[model samples]
Target: MCGKRIDHAEWRLTKSIVDIERLRAVAAKHNVKIPDDEEDYYRHLLNGLDATAQQVADLPEYEDPRLQIEPETLPRQWFKQKPNPLNGWSHRAEIKLPSPKDKRLDNRTVAFKDNVSIGGVPLTGGTTPEILTGKSEYPVPKIDAVVVKRVLEAAGTVSGSANCEHLSMSPLSFTSFTGPIHNPWARGYTTGGSSSGCAALVGINQVKEWRKRHGLPPIDEELGEGVDMAIGGDQGGSIRLPSAYAGIYGMKPTHGLVPYSGILSLFPMIDHTGPMTTNLEDLATLLGVVAGYDGIDPRCTPETPLREKVPDYSAQLASFKQTKQAAGEWTTSAAGKGLRIGVITESLAVPNLSPEIFKVIQEAISQFESIGASVSHISIPEHLLGPSIWTIATRAGIASLGMRNMPPPLLCYPCPDITPPALSQSSFDILDRHNPASANMVFNATLLQERPDGASLAAKAMMHVHELRAAYDRALTEVDVLITPVITRMHSQHPSLDAKVEDKMKPAIGSTLNTCQFNVTGHPALSMPAGWGKAEDGDAKMPVAMQIIGKRFDEESVIKAAAAWEVGGLGLDKWDGR
Candidate 1:
């Protein structure tokens, strides 16, 4: 009777022999009915009790323990998470010489971004599932990407590939599906990316297991006791952003300064690959190995040399050290004399900027003023200030080309005929809410349209492009270099999983606003780590970065200015765990 419900008639029959007599008395007081027939009444009572017990057991409080614990603390006995396809060896193999007479790069170990293909290693490009399935296909590359072949020939050995932004699309390292690129300076904050892995390996300590396998020294040993450098690519700040976040020096070089063949293409018009490293000398040395013109890359000019035949970067390093040693005292009037620095007002006016970043920029200007350099705030044309229509046009062109060129099976994965199930599902989700016929109607209209023969839309777009380039050239007239924040906002605080695509996109658009336009206009730009600031995590300080933009092909001038900043004691002293 324990406050249970049962049918009535059976209770009276069961009263003569069983505990139903007590049950009936309780039920009668509550005006409840019980089933008839002694056995039937008893069975009904049991069923009622069983049903109540089942409901209680089904309550949230009685659910499985596995779902209740934090993922980090979950038992190892549970199934392990899938290993990231993008992970690879962190150190380089010793370069075995073809002959004793062949020159070597003095035992320097070079690691390449995963997107760059090495003969046998998996080129995952962060999340190209096709590579993992043994079904991946690539046309016979006409030649090693000019940079890859050049680096190898220069006595650099390929270490294992490093992770990158998925498809190298985003500037934030965390957007990488393999893992968030951890900041070497601070463990909790993000390493700037799509060159995330390239920065991480150079910036942070390598895993002990990898060090043992490659017979290479640990990161602490390498940075503190030896030297190592990372070579990576940039499209819209990939190389520069990571270098800034990792607190290292990086150079994007002039557009087409390094050949782009055999590298994964993001936007060819804006993409440039270059070096990332802790020391300026290391960057110079690495760049010397990889920079060259390749006939395969249409953008590469034959005039560009494979290596700048300078006396040695060590000499430049020594000079920089000497300058730092001079402190506030100037040895000569030439110190910063005639140096013109322009601050782009449009870059500063972008919204959501952390006050600390602004402070760093202001402090840098004061430093320049303390010396003999002239600093002024300048405005770029409103239309040319941020990334413009060209950005979208280039990206669309690349994507369309990639899709059209992909092998039939690769394009239609998981179905190989018709559209892929996975792809169709995702596509329909975007199309479902809209009228299905609208897409076809728009396509047909565009196909059927006729317009005036001359002064066509394409011609108009070309004119706009020229106008923008002219505007940028004019803006640089009064300034030796334009200065702007590396990113509009501070580095994100949460782990990679917490960030959304839009979160990465917003900052990328802002940061690349000042950098990418230069690429379209064929100017050179360098991003230097200016300082650091408190991250949202309140544990590690994220890097504060600034960009120095120079006129087209003026790589040497941009390099010299960046050198000045590094020599001026603006570079980070240590990025080891903040």
Candidate 2:
């Protein structure tokens, strides 16, 4: 084993690595000193620690299931200075690993968020090596994320990595190492992030495809090639917020529905990664390919179905679309005949929600009603407190586990590519320069760690999650889907790189007001673009989205509702003031 193995009793007797100074330093930090009589007693007790650690250290590395990628899945190339024009691509996926045996994602090109590992590819988590280590280097992962394997197994071609917000922190774009990710709908503004580039690429693809289908010309030549779908991560509102701003569909499936193994996590409890696509059909299909219990992440419980048993979400949505139209009625109330929609009364009360954006969502609801779905205001008072609960429950844990890369409280896969040296002033400055939101989270954690009641406060907030979930459950009992707006405003322009932290972080404040609740409640939430809204700073019209949330593991209803509203009602890619 590690060095020569000695007798079991000898470990306790050996000097090992714990020296007198080391023990003294630890004691001083706590304002304590070992009595002279007990010095050797304590020293010997601590000396055995290194020997015990060596035993585990000498053990073989874990055989990660993510490493079982089939042949032909080798990665291609990574980009340097100039990223794709939209600043979307982190690399080019010249490698095509197709499974002729599969159909769900046959020939679809899919990009994984930079934080999700793709074997032999650099896992950026949206920062250069110089940001963390003062060297231009990045960790190339040897394993593919569980979702990557599943996507390939389903016949999807890997379309390389997409730029994400630095360390997957910000809810709005402009925090990426490469640069800002332009919103496809409004070039100089944001494509909300840390799933930033994923949304940008998918949004562009959606627009181009929609135009081509209508016999219109291509939007531009800037979008070189294309991606049909993207697998994006979400801890707070990364996926949904970006999708909302970019005018596409993004889903955060029930917490455990999609195995999160091999992806960087912000907090083990809230970690999620799901599909973002141009349309609901692709979203449903890609989600099915990546979902189900992988027997790795502990988040997946006994209730999680086996991979083979996962529901055929795309097929089910198609069936519902056909079933509704089979009635042969084109009247005002034919499409959404049996759907029940709930508007979260508290969601509309968010402090900064603009009247114009409010009207966009209101009109979306009316459109649902016009297509025959019954709508009512459903109140969950706890929703007002959701963002607060999410913060207190997750901040310290995210600081200790997410930012610092420490071991978590549960058994789950941790993407080893992310190894931070430790939390220090230098590291904090580097992180803050990239994304102030992340720095704020770390500071909150630091403050909490010093308070005696911090752990208990977090625990109590976690307990309240059950109350919040039950409240939503009660609301859902009265309706099939619960809907809310994704954000209070349209995407904003990126601040100068050297801008003040407060100024840089301004756009992200309250950005997650309506999205983070479900992250903690473990519900399936999707952001569906309802219409367009005028940009606050420009003549450009930005995409507006309304969220659709469903009961845990009931993604079928969530997808079906959105699809009906899309295909059977007002249809996708709608315009403002329509």
Candidate 3:
């Protein structure tokens, strides 16, 4: 479309589909008023443009450099089963790493969210294939997501794709067409979603580990081999919510810390992908591999560290462990002496915060003193406005871009092979019929676009994100990290597929209120398993989670703080009902 960037003849090319009658049809389609008298004048102009489009389409396409790999490297197959037992895996694979020198992740298994691309693998995106092609065939990506490539380069084995929410929109596991992802701790209950399968896969592995450590035999529900770690996408708490619900560790790194290239973007501003694992070391190790600038993602700002400059999170945690052990403080009160942890007062007041989880997190935060860390209550009033700002700022963009199959205006590699079908009323109804949130998001977008002052409000909200970021940066100066409960409540059982829209969406209310703030502010946030709480439906226990927020790009401090607490404060085992 850039006339100056191409041959002149492409723009000047003659005669096309529309002469006069066809032109009238086009104008009518767009509801444009064109004078009948001027039809001939406009006809020639439109023909030139149409010819130029054809000429540009005829030119050789530029291939993105990232896809160039050894031939036959991606030996692939389609998943025969629709929804597996845990309903966690979208595809199953046993991909080995290329000859990695460091071998940091040798023999470790990693699960990628279904939204992430892995060459030659069918990407369900947690929705049915019929929506896109009107056939059974799903789109198979030929490019590996940046994180997927990194994991393979580090000697990790790709376990397969983890099921996610439909359209990557819902925060409940129940919405995926693949079916409800069972909680590892309690079946039939949700492992909070969008990154539903990631959490379930990692969470199940943790449960297995606990059972093995206790010398207990595996139960029927503990049959499958889940992944050692996962790479999950987060726009508004997708990664953290599932991790929290599943009783594992998930970190949404400071925006752009991980290159989001090759992944289907939800919203460029809030889009993020990061590690979710059973423990800190794995989380740290995997993050270290993926946390560097790819130079293409718009989110990877100038502030992003280069690949070599990216901290070795595993090495950093190792050093902390060494220093503590050598000082005879490995499991003693001296471990967190220099750490400053702040509890955000406004965060606790977020509506829908469960009394059960709120109390557990309070008790957990108070235990920081036992490990010699200072836990102070910090007030950031702007935190309360984050949900509203994030909504007004992103709802329109997320809808229009997603619905019409338009990419954002960011400079990044384009996935050429995949073609998203334009949403027809039938397709829209198909999606809206299953998930109320999907309809709500699109309706909200239309509501905003139709309002005379809606764009103005969105613009102002975007501007204020900077203000919110600065407020947090100032608070972070006085504290190493800020802490809060992961959200207003814990994940609940799946609502029936035939349930009313209100009933289907009831559990997701306020789920993202606390988590979405960091997505907008671009701060790194970690969701760590805090403790076990009784499920609303029964006496069986489910995991409770707490949020740890850090200054942008400072993932090392956040990881170390979690490690310090697990090692010297209330142990993760104690939190897990050990």
- Residue 455 CA error for candidate 3 (Å)? 1.7
lDDT tens readout by residue for model 1, 1-578? 56544447654444333255666776788797776755455555655665667777787432222112223211212111123222322223333223322243556666678666544344556553432222344222222345555655666654546777655656666555455656655555667777877876666532233245456555553222112666788866788887777666677877777776656665556668888776666776776566665545555655455445422444554565476447643322234655787888877766666787787777666666655677888877653433654553344433433222232221111111111112244333222221122122223233423344322543454456666677667777887887887766676643434444344344444656556666666566777777767664465567677878887666555655566555445535323333
Q: For all the candidates, what are their Cα RMSDs to the real structure?
A: 21.5, 2.7, 3.0
* TM-scores of the candidates in the order shown: 0.66, 0.94, 0.93
Give the range where candidate 1 is weakest over 10 consecutive residues by summed lDDT: 411-420
After superposition, the stretches of candidate 3 with alpha carbons farther than 4 Å from their true spots are: 1-16, 19-38, 58-62, 72-74, 81-83, 133-136, 220-223, 569-572, 575-578
Sliding window of 10 residues with minimal summed lDDT for model 2: 569-578
Task: Give the Å shift of residue 80 in candidate 1.
Answer: 18
Kindly list the per-residue Cα lDDT of model 2 for residues 129-211, writing each as its tens digit: 75443446888777788988888777788878998998898998899878888887667898898899899889888878766
Q: lDDT by residue for model 3 over 78-158, one digit each (tens)? A: 554343678888888767655764688988999999988887778887777776445578887767888887888888888
The CA lDDT of each predicted structure is 0.56, 0.82, 0.82
lDDT of 3 at 567: 64
Count of backbone collisions within predicted model 3: 1
Assess the local accuracy of residue 321 in candidate 1 as a C-alpha lDDT between 0 and 100: 46
